[model samples]
Target: MLKPSTLNNKLRVLLIEDDTIEVMKLKRAIAKLEMPHEIVEAKNGEEALDILRNRDSLPDLILLDLNMPRINGLEFLKILKNDEVMRFLPVVILTTSSNRKDMLECYKEGVAGYILKPLKYDDYVEKISTTLNYWSSNELIKG
Candidate 1:
């Protein structure tokens, strides 16, 4: 079991994914890890932006999907990077897209990490666990 405090001062996550099935699976994986986290969900990048802009408490990390309705991931990343208040927040591109151009673009825009969504449930769980562990171990979570 991974202890959230061991990785950083605080643990919170904002996930922007449009797929309901994927969201359910992700929630199950998070539950299995028993890691302390305040998970916030958004159906698309537009909703995510609204939340980030209005919410008083910002998340330590954001897991974003590239393909979404109403403001895609790349557009959201651009807006976030430009904002003085939001630019510092770490963002990880979590999506199914394996396009080289997309990868390069995201890196250029300052994404902390990029992860391809796995097809299998177990594989997906492992990926999520590893990502969480890596961030925690690296102390990437904001205070």
Candidate 2:
């Protein structure tokens, strides 16, 4: 069992995004949040899955993009949901897709949250910060 304070301090975040520009924007937004987080970047779902499998400590949360080359977000979510160890970790769909079907499917597949990426830089910062703050303060799991 992981301690609450330890989990708070080492809140690992995995962002699976392919767009270089979006990645840069998100990185800056995350930096401005001023939280003690270890951010890991994955260009696509395959790489993210590889890291999740190989790493000893899995990320506390995953910010997943819906579309990408190789394995897409839905496919990756299916695989992760089926895995007993990984299923417990919260997966948030942070993508540009505003498709209703995609959003519905993501929820059906057990995504913890679905956030459409804000087009503006300032909004992006605020949204990310609020989301992270909420998750950090909440008692997600009990030891």
Candidate 3:
């Protein structure tokens, strides 16, 4: 467990994923990194839109899963990019799909980055840790 005194800045990350197990894995990975980040979750794109619209402050970044129950990641990306307030927000796709079509589409829709999930836990942790580190070091626009 991380002591509050030792913790640094908490970067808010909106995680839009439908699978409960995948969400848990991601949480574990972030925790292992000890990155001092906060995660807000949504099961699907519609839910994510609602959360974004209702909240006063926006997150530093969004971690999106392409294969979701409703409105999927691509649709979510489109909606987010179209919105005036959320258009500038960074969105990174974390997904199992490695399809070239999907990758091109996400880039077309304005995703900041696209990450393919590794099958192994250790690899996943490593990937997540690196991503967190990079984002933490970079400056994000104030919401």
Candidate 4:
């Protein structure tokens, strides 16, 4: 498990999701962790791209959902991974998609990790906590 002390700086997370309930669940899971991480949200990949383009800085990590109204996760991943500036930013797939193709594609495109959102609340919390712990302990490309 990763200790908060292991990470001297607060994590900056960008959540790209379209479902309101799922977003709430993710926020709840994050709150349960009690880590001092900052989260920014985008409803879809298009909005996420716009946010990335307009912002002067990028988030340390990006939590992406596979399904959305515009510019689905795979497409977004392609765009992000191809960019010289954004390619270094770590991206994690946090979606319910269990597609083998999706999994393979994300890995090929350079996702830090691929996590399927659990059906139960406790399971969800555990998954989120473990993921954060691992990422928090490991050194990122940004470092």
Candidate 5:
């Protein structure tokens, strides 16, 4: 169950990750942090795209993973950036890849942020908490 937003600003986050463990970790982190944001999960980029295309109300932010089967994160980002409506949606890359090239490409494609998954669980939780807090405070465009 999700807690009520104490900050009076809740966010709907679309998490595009292929690893089940990673997905569970994020959920656990949110719960531990006592954040009231809603999480919408997608196993991969393709699934995420489908969800985005069919949803009535779009998510406030997208937490994307770079490596996945089918359409990779970069490919998905390209497609999303080309879309008229979805292009404005903030996409934050959350992945283990620290490749400078990948980072540059993501920035070139206009990602809101790029975060490396920390080795320590505590560090991961901290990063997630900080990222969510920042986005929650931002004035997001409601589609």
Candidate 6:
């Protein structure tokens, strides 16, 4: 089990991914870990943008995948970074892509962290748990 953060506060996370399995894996991991964080899912960049635009309460963290159907992760990152209000929101690249170019670009585009998805279910869970635990300890800005 993952250790609880010092703040012990729940986080509203925006998870933008096109893969159904990936989404399910994350949800399952969260459930298994018994985290209290709220996850808001978006199938792609377009849908994520719509959610960001319309939602009254924005998410504290965004877990983005690089490859998607429409408006890929890089494009979405550009758009999000350009938005004055949304730019401050911490976005972490949670993707399968291990390409150095992609990693560098995401960092350039201002992602908080870049993580490659593990093939093993247990590893995946551990990575997600660690990431969440680290972020939860930080003083995240509420947007």
TM-score of 3: 0.90
- Model 2 per-residue lDDT tens digits across residues 26-85: 777766665676789999988998899975868878999999999999999999999999
Candidate 2, pairs of clashing residues: none
Query: Over the stretch 22-76, how does candidate 4's per-residue lDDT look in tens digits?
Result: 8898888777777777789999998999889955769888999999887999999
Model 6: residue 100 alpha-carbon error in angstroms? 0.2
Relative to the unseen true structure, what is the Cα RMSD of model 4? 2.0
- The true-versus-predicted C-alpha distance at residue 92 of model 6, in Å, is 0.5
Write model 5 residue lDDT over 1-143, tens digit each, in one string: 23334654788899999999999999999989888889999998889989999657689999999999999999999999999999999999999999999999999999999999999999999899888888887767332
Computed on alpha carbons, the lDDT of every model, listed in order, comes to 0.85, 0.83, 0.85, 0.85, 0.90, 0.91
Largest TM-score belongs to which candidate? 6
Task: List ranges where model 1 is wrong by over 4 Å.
Answer: 1-10, 140-143
What digit string (tens of lDDT, one per residue) describes model 3 on residues 13-92? 99999999999999988777766788999999999998899657688889999998769899889989998889988999
Give per-residue CA lDDT, model 1, range 16-125, as digits (tens). Answer: 99999878888998888776667899999888988898758788889999999889999999999999989989899999999999999999999999999988877887
**Candidate 5 off by > 4 Å:** 1-5, 141-143
Candidate 2: global Cα-lDDT? 0.83
- lDDT winner between candidates 4 and 5: 5
Q: At residue 51, what lDDT does model 3 achieve?
A: 87
Cα RMSD, model 5: 3.1
Give candidate 2's error at residue 52 in angstroms: 0.7
Give per-residue lDDT, candidate 5, residue 93: 99
What's the TM-score of each model vs. the native?
A: 0.89, 0.89, 0.90, 0.90, 0.93, 0.94
| Deviation in Å, model 2, residue 83 alpha carbon | 0.4
Clashes per candidate, residues 3 or more apart or on different chains: 0, 0, 0, 0, 0, 0
Per-residue error for 123 in candidate 1, Å, reads 1.5
